[model samples]
Target: MPAESQRLYERIAQKLANDISRGQYKIGQRLPSERELAQTFSVSRPTVREAIIALELDRLVEVRVGSGVYVTNTEPPGGKAGATDIGPFELLEARRSIEGEACALAATRIDDAQLAELNALLTEMRTENEKDVMLSEDADRRFHETIAAATQNSGMIAAVKMLWDARTRSPQSRSLSAKVRATGVKPRIDEHTAILKALRQRDPEGARAAMREHLTRVIDALLKATEVQELERARQQIAEQRKRYAASQ
Candidate 1:
């Protein structure tokens, strides 16, 4: 894909790769901190994280937890990082929009059988979360798929399925998801329960809001999960300074 058409993270990845190839970041050397990279690229920390994951996928870098990203190779073995896959945050935003509408439609169209299925899936999700939080993703996927099916629209079902497939197939997205899961962030049963309640009540707007809220929280969770520990503490200190300034004023 052309640089102009590429996602922000992909573009950043390409730039970083070029720098690496030029020996700006020699093999075995630690790259700048995530905070520094974000400022240098004028992008968010999460976008920088996505770029780092792309580099990792291309075998150009390695991420060490609680340390920093390191240059593993001067050039990507595949010649370039995976640029075609959607970014994790981008996918979540798309889901928030598409699935919110699908849930709204399902509110009116869902039957008792589908509702029963969704309820069962909710139970499964809760149980899996209790057993091992990471294990709930499968049931979570089914829960959304079931909601899409309840819409009774083939197009909606396909669209939802495509999004889920993208989540699985995108190397960058999958890496980021794995990172998030490693941080102990699992599917929120209460959020799913709220959606089910709205659906059972046959409330379209309520369902839409519930779904959107759920996905919005998911986005927030991803951002938090990917944050570097030092950067998080820095952010907390900044917040405290701002509070103090406000009190002084």
Candidate 2:
């Protein structure tokens, strides 16, 4: 596909996904008419239809008989938001820019009530089970977004919201998350805890530094995983070629 098309779909899909998850369009709520979406997106009607169809494929929305599109039963896919395609490096870089600022602003303005909410989320997520760890990191994203709101910076709020959406929805995000949690990455957990502490203390700079460190650790881990995935892809390709050659012989 053309680069422009790729970019357009990526943006539109993310917006649609956000609307669904944020309940801008409630479950079973009919989406705006395709004509309306096309005007809203400032693109062709076919482009709007394609976008909607793509969303339906992901189970984010449904098309009902004689009614407009409706959000379906399924949760929107995480991390990439609705991005149809995004590579690991792009994702990590985006995370750095957004979370780095979110933590900074959060420190400046987070209230006791917000801290309590985060504490509750931390309890729900952080655990060392005998055999498994349940990493509810979207809870982590929600906390960050809430903090962005506390900063009362609209730009910060919007940017962090998008990054958080992508972070929570990407397939690679999910896979690496499960991998990291399963392997027991403890210091990273500590980093988040420390960031939370900084927020509780209302130290903006401290919160920023802690968030930066946390993201740095996550990026390093993701790069290693990306390398492994590259190797695996190469191996799979070679194996398939070998099978074909043997059959031809």
Number of the top lDDT candidate: 1
Q: Encode model 2's per-residue lDDT on 147-177: one tens digit a residue.
A: 7787778888888777767756766455545
Cα lDDT, model 1, residue 77: 82
Instruction: List, residue by residue over 121-230, the lDDT tens digit for candidate 1.
Output: 99998889878765699999999999999999999999999999999888888788778878889899899999999999999999999999999999889887886544
**TM-score for predicted model 1 compared with the true structure:** 0.85
Could you estimate the TM-score for every candidate?
0.85, 0.51
Error of 1 at 25 (Å): 1.9
Show where candidate 1 strays beyond 4 Å. 78-80, 231-249
Clashing pairs in 2: 78-168, 78-169, 78-170, 79-166, 79-167, 79-168, 79-169, 79-170, 80-170
Report the lDDT of model 1 for residue 153: 96
Clashes, model 1? 0
